[model samples]
Target: MLRALRTAALGMSAQQTSVDNTANNLANANTTGFKRATVVFQDLLYQSVQRGGEGDQRPAAMQLGSGSAIVATQRTFLQGSLMQTGNSLDLAVNGEGFLQARRPDGSVVYTRDGAFTLDADGRIVTQSGLALEPDLEVPPETQEIQISSDGVVRVRLQNEPDALEIGRIEVAQFSNPAGLRSIGANLYEQTEASGEPQIGPPAEGGAGLLQQGFLETSNVDVVQEMVDLITAQRAYEMNSKMITTSEEMLQIANSMKR
Candidate 1:
């Protein structure tokens, strides 16, 4: 009875984690460049008993599994749908890669959100004021900005007849992008498991091409997340019922007269 109770408790704990992850995904369904995460579970070690005897026609060793646990939460890197906002500053990646951004401490972070804006110094920056990597500076008299699929930034000045090239935006890739640590605000930090970032221009070396006037939508599927939430809820309820049944069985056993 105690083993059953403990097993059910472990199951409930695992289901809680699943529910949390599902809720987060659902909440970020409309977030730009958001990636959905899923919980990975692993069965606990087994308790062995009654080893088989040699040449005695007895079965092999029998074991009872302790339960399950949430081993890891894996981020899915599936490509998100693109939303055309018609904003010149908005950009989207059509494939694999991440845009580079520098934090206040000068540390680099990776992101798929390309909703960039200009800062007071005319430098291209994210919505949170972090400067984009490579430090592009738009001239004061710039009348129009244009980004090419190849990541070239061209601008037309107020008095200029021809467009001039400003800079090129490059993307970074990792061997295992899912290994990155999420630091919030659509940013990701590299880790040993993620490997070093490979920086280069778009549409090269497995990097995605840039799409001007568009933004990458969150990859989370609301219907799928809802199903997962329902499944997790059911699992939790079942675990609770198992604990209650086990407790009732213990009560019945205790009521038996000697």
Candidate 2:
């Protein structure tokens, strides 16, 4: 009975983690470059029971198992559809890699969201106003802005029809992105497990080609999440039933006449 209770508790805990993951995805459905996370679970250690009679002499080693555990949290890197916002600062990645942004604390962060805007200083900034790594600055007198297919940023000068180049956007990648830690606000931090960030120009080394005037949407699949939710709910209920049954048996055994 005690073992069953422990198993039930572990199952409940795992389900809670799954629920949290799903809820977070729903909340970020509208967030740009926000990758949804899923919790990975693994069964606890298991002990084998006796099998064959001849071999049973080896002591079946009474079967035992610990509850489940959270093995990891997986981030989905699936590409999101692009939405055209007609803003020069709004950019999207057509393929692999992520954009490097400069956090306020001076630490570098990576993201897929390119919904950018200009700060008072005419510096290119993300929707959250974080500056890009390379830092592209436009002239305050420029009337219109344009970004080339190769990620070259420039603006139209009043006296010149030609667009004067400003700066090129830089893209980054990791050998194992699953090791990244989410720091909230659609930003990811590098870790030893994820390998060092590979800084390079867009469209290089499997990095995504930059697409200006657009933004990448979240890649979460609502249908898949719904199915997983059902499975977790059913498994949790079954574990609860097992615990309840074990408790009833214990109660009945204790009721016997002393």
Candidate 3:
């Protein structure tokens, strides 16, 4: 009975995590450059109640499981919807890799969201206003801007027909992206298990190509999330039923003792 209760509790806990993950993905469905995360679970160790032996001894009988554990929260590298914003500074990745941004604390961060804006000081930044890495700063006198597919920043010269090169956007890549831990802020932190981040220009190596005036929309599918929510809810109910059944069995055992 105790084992049954523990197993039910663990199963419900794992299902709760799955529901949470799916809910979060649904919430970020419209978020730019947002990547969907899937929860991975594994069963706990099984206990053998019946021991194996020769000479008329029964074979080992295995317990179902103690419970389940959230093994990992894997990020879906699958591409999101690419929507054109038509803004000069607004950019999106056409392929893989992330745009590097510098935080206020001088720490570097990465994002797949390419919806960028130019600050009052002519500095390129995200909507949340995090400055782009490599420091793309346009001159005060610059009239127009143009970002190449390769991520080169350029500005039109005054009274001139051509644009001048400024800087290139820096992108980062990872080896084991599935190992990344989500620390909220729609950001991921680096870990030894994920390996060191590989920094490079857009489209260089496996880095994704940059698209001017485009933004990467979240990849979450609403219908899929709905189905998952229903499944999780059902699993939670089943676990509750297991607990009830275990309690009833215990009650029956007590009646026999009486």
Candidate 4:
């Protein structure tokens, strides 16, 4: 009965983690460049009840699982739908890649949110003021900014009929993007599991092409998340019932008359 109580409690805890992950996904359903994460569960260590003899015809062992645990939360990197914003500064990656941004601490991070804007100094930066990697700077008197599908940045200055090339936007790819750590604000840091970033120009070397005037929407599906939430709730309830029944069984055993 005690083992049952502990196992049911662990099951409840695992279900709670699942619910939390589903809630986060639902909350970010409308966030730009947001990816939905799914909870991964693993069975806990098993306790052996009987070990069969070497020459016995029966099974080698009889075991009972302790419970389940939340092993990892994996983010789905599937491409989100692209929404056209008509703002030249807004960008979207049409394939597999992430834009590099320089954080406040001078360390580089990866992101899929390309809703960039020119800061006071005419430097293209994210909403958090983090400058894009490679440092694209526009002239003060520039009339128009144009970004090509190949990540080329060109600007037309005042009274200048010709467009001048400024700089190029580059994207990075990882062997395992799901291994990247989320630091909020649409930024991800590479870890050992993610491997080193492969920085290159967009539309070349397996990198994704850039789309100006567009932004990638979150990949969360509301209906799916709702289903997962319901499933988690049901599992949690079942575990709670199991714990209650185990307690009742213990009480009955203790109340026996001799």
Reference-based lDDT, each prediction: 0.95, 0.84, 0.84, 0.94
Show model 1 residue runs off by greater than 4 Å: 53-57
Tens-place lDDT per residue, model 3, 79-188, is 88889889888788888787788889998877887777789998988778888898988988889999988888889978878899999887888898766666666566
lDDT of 1 by residue, 82-132 (tens): 999999989999999999999989999999999999999999999999999
Pairing residues by index, what is the TM-score of model 3?
0.92
Candidate 4 clash pair list: none
Model 3: CA > 4 A from native: 51-64
Error of 3 at 119 (Å): 1.9
**Tens digit of per-residue lDDT, candidate 4, span 1-258:** 999999999999999999989989988999999999999999999887876664575657788899999999999999999999999899999999999999878899999999999999999999999999989999999999999999999999999999999999999999999999999999999999999999999988898999999999999999999899999999999999999999999989988964
For candidate 4, the clash count comes to 0
Candidate 3 whole-model C-alpha lDDT, 0 to 1: 0.84
Residues 1-258, model 2: lDDT tens digits: 788888888988888788778888877878888887888889898866555344636533566787897888899888888988888778998888888889878999988888888899989888778998888888988989988766788899888879898888888889998889888778889999989988888887888888988899888878877887788788878888888898998898899966
Indicate which candidate wins on lDDT.
Answer: 1
CA RMSD per model (angstroms):
1.2, 2.1, 2.0, 1.1
User: Which scores higher on lDDT, 2 or 4?
Assistant: 4
Q: How many steric overlaps does candidate 1 have?
A: 0
For every model shown, the clashing-pair count is 0, 0, 0, 0
Error of 1 at 167 (Å): 1.0
